[model samples]
Target: MLASASASKAACNQETLNTTSFNYVNDIENQTVHDIAVKFNRGVCDIGRANLMVDVSVVPNVGQTIIIPGQVCHPDWTTCVIDGPGTNDCLIGGPRLYYTLNGDTMWKIAGRLNMTLDAVTCGGDSCNTNITCIDGICPGGGGSQYTANETIPAGQFIKIPITCDIEPYTFSAGVYKDLAEKYGSTVGQIQMLSPTYNYSYIANEGGTFPPIALAKNCRLLSSNYTILS
Candidate 1:
């Protein structure tokens, strides 16, 4: 179906970061998934998979939010939310590199990536002790070290701890139980992976979550070992 409004007016004009695979766009007017996909220069299936939308052929409700994949920021921007080697290639978890965006804080970064503040601050189980910040403000700097809540400037790359590689998921109208079933993960593990949301609250559905980190079937190899021993 065609969009009721002009495609140019309904275009996905949101800000994006480098390597940031998923982006959120609000539907100001009536449009089908195909219409939105065409505006974004992507396939309907790709958008559906990224957003976990059930129907790709139907027209979306007005003011509905949609997720677009493979959209990127300008080439000059160094900021990004690195999602690892994706789900296809098996790899080990370690410090994932994330370049800071303007007005970005450790907590915001963790929430944006579906990670815990501890993981972003290098104090959690996912952090590799051997790998520390080489360019940005790190955990320890005698007196200049910034806390997770402090704002970090753009273009500074930071190392984030990870237990396993991850794949992104957008939450629909579902609880943790539904999310766990969909991803073949336990509710507790999912909660840990996404600590930004309080488990007791059920109204927070239809939001984006940190990419689900892989625990099983990880293909370990010498090349995945990017950390220096």
Candidate 2:
């Protein structure tokens, strides 16, 4: 009986060892499976890398819209509060060059600028019509008419016709002569039309009054002549 009892105790000890070994293997397998699942989840959510790029040079002028790429962070870095290029709108208005004339006819301004009437009026109404006549009738004239030039307010602004010449760039009697010759006008007529220009010569440049003939040839590039009150 004693031998049989000892054998039974040994068999029970063996059974316990077997159960512990199986449990250890199962625990290790479960841990490995958990680690793999965690890694798979991270991979699935990862955004990886972005190959997109923004080219600022391609942006169009203002008032025009453009489509920009979207990223994990806002792709419009220019507009973003953070990580933005900088403040102020990136797009800008188109190029605009304008000139104001004080005379009524295109021919007058053309003569002033030393340009042909056709050249100055090439753009039609906007180039040739007066600012007042843009919407309302011109004062002192009939038929809802607009002047071909801007109505400069007295003492508000001065409009002068300037000419770009190759030699004697400064305003002088010789320059005036060149202008008159080019524009088919008399020196006296030019002097009468632009008396302010003559005054500017005495006041600003401190030069003696030039000959009326040379003054006629002078081409206007800029003028210091101001409107009178």
Candidate 3:
């Protein structure tokens, strides 16, 4: 119901990259379909609302394989564990640009949007400030991370991240308020997206994931032409 979160978050999706294989082993001797189904239920939350491709029936044995999810995996992230709060699912979405007005501070802009410094910065430690570049919206030389004191000139477009949460369940490691705050949303909104622990007496059921949980879908178009020899 928070429409101000914008359509820009919905503008991009990532191409499935080839993964370096990783999986957890169910070393028990007689693992059944039920066992794997329990594991399958723990699959990645597809960020762009895509259907996951599963192939467990073909190899229902002691050495079950599960591909680690996402466009890329970090060095520390290796195996899919039981009830893990581990997957860092960020969509490959294009930033929505914001223009700097006269006397605009990076802090002010970030604060207004509830965006983290990590979201808007150009990335890397230092940005190009030469050629008369002012503020942290340093265009060129690989944009630097946002700094608190950057004095942006008027008419400069700042890149704002289209942040999204793609993990299937609420990962336990993060501060709940930060996530809600970062997206300019509420903790209830986050709770609404993730599966929650339920009480035994309540007859509650989970609805489909909130559409806002994902980044806007992105696609790539490629073309090929054959020239007459």
Candidate 4:
């Protein structure tokens, strides 16, 4: 797995976003958007929005055509880090659209993204208005937005407020401080990812540590990026 990951990274480096164009493929194996993104070393949201998928996480029908966009790294892959408001933890390049799946709610979605409900909703910035509704029927308009937590019906694509991209990692044998130092993260940030853990206690052998988002270059997104930045 390590060898394959390295090769994929090498392949990704060879392809630049400026020179690469859209690549088309057929879902003969019945793959999801995530699967295609991993196979092509692109971001899931990139392929999802490019194909205008109502549910980015859903698997495409067999033989359906999918469009893969050119991206330098997976949306969750952080390239570099910059000084930020909190602890200088790594943040994603920009916010990515999260399409609601069945049984999705505000609290559940926030937890999956490892974000506080308040941060997910309006972390220091006002809520974004550019929502793309599925089924061609928008809920609210004319200065009134549908907003979060109201039914949160499936197939709705909402812009996730920009936050750090978290990757799950298991600690070999160390306390929170050791893991944080190894990953260039802070203890407070690590605790946020796995709040139940006792940071001071040494982790049990083979016990998996909480997920962490490594630092990366965070080029703030402008207001006008159509799908993703």
Whichever of 2 and 4 has more TM-score, that candidate is: 4
Question: lDDT, candidate 3, residue 219?
Answer: 20
Alpha-carbon runs more than 4 Å astray in model 1: 1-95, 124-144, 161-229
Instruction: Give TM per candidate.
Output: 0.27, 0.21, 0.23, 0.28
Compared with the true structure, all predictions reach lDDT values of 0.41, 0.25, 0.31, 0.41
Off by over 4 Å in 3: 1-95, 122-146, 162-229
Model 3 root mean square deviation, Cα atoms: 20.7
Worst 10 residues of 2 by lDDT: 44-53
TM-score of 3: 0.23
Q: lDDT by residue for model 3 over 1-229, one digit each (tens)? A: 1121232234433353443333445466555333443343322222101212111111233554333333332211111111211111111222334555434455544433333343334343222121122343322212144465566655565543222333444222222333444544433223223322211111111224222242222321223211110
**Residue pair clashes in candidate 3:** 9-216, 10-216, 12-217, 12-218, 13-218
Candidates 1 and 3, the one with greater lDDT: 1
Model 2 Cα displacement at 133 (Å)?
25
Which candidate number would show the highest TM-score if scored against the true structure?
A: 4
lDDT of 3: 0.31
Per-residue error at 64 for model 2, in Å?
Answer: 48
